[model samples]
Target: MPAPTEMPTKHSTPYPTWEQFQQMEKRQDALEKRQDTTDRRLDSGAGEFAEIKKAQDTLRQQQAAHGQTVAEVREILAELRELVESFGNLKGTIRVMRIAGDVIRWGCTLGAAALGLWVAFRSLGGGL
Candidate 1:
């Protein structure tokens, strides 16, 4: 009987063709390019986000300033109201003074008329 043919053992390393090696190199280069583009996009987006945050901060500061202005206006209004009230009181005081002056003038006129009548009656020989 013939001896059984032995099957060849499989080789440890498979030889890659030159075309396969070039294809792998190209794929690696494309992957590196994609990564670089992604990094640049992330950097640009971060810069834009920072600008937006700065704008938001500025807006908040402006709002705070506006609030302060409103508060100051309210204080000024209160002061104006106080001044108006004092002015009203002064007007009332002036009105009372005018009335009192009129009363005094009337009293003086009546006293003078009575004195004149008395003097005339004495001159005419009438008893006091």
Candidate 2:
């Protein structure tokens, strides 16, 4: 009779050693530790996200307030422009009045000089 050969069954691993089981358990433990670290990092990220949202809100409010201030400044500039235009018109009117005053003063000076010269000539000619 021939010696019976050991046959591998379809559903069985011939043999898994004790060391292999221990290695698998150690790998599982390491994986669990890595998962815990990842979870902690994700929790910290959520807190950072909340802080970023708060900062964004603060910036939005400041932008809104600045817009209102800009509008007010524009209004003030418009009023200042109108005042400057009025001042220009008033300056032109004052210049016209100054010219009229100078013309009257010169006319009076010439008339007085002419009258004085006529009187001097008449007195000298024996028509005192």
- What is candidate 2's lDDT per residue for 71-105, written digit by digit as tens? 99999999999999999999998999989889988
Poorly placed runs, candidate 1 (over 4 Å):
1-16, 115-128
TM-score of 1: 0.65
lDDT, candidates in the order shown = 0.89, 0.88
Per-model TM-score versus the true fold: 0.65, 0.63
Question: Which is the leading candidate under lDDT?
Answer: 1
**Model 2: worst 10 consecutive residues (lDDT sum):** 1-10
**Cα-based lDDT at residue 61, candidate 2:** 100
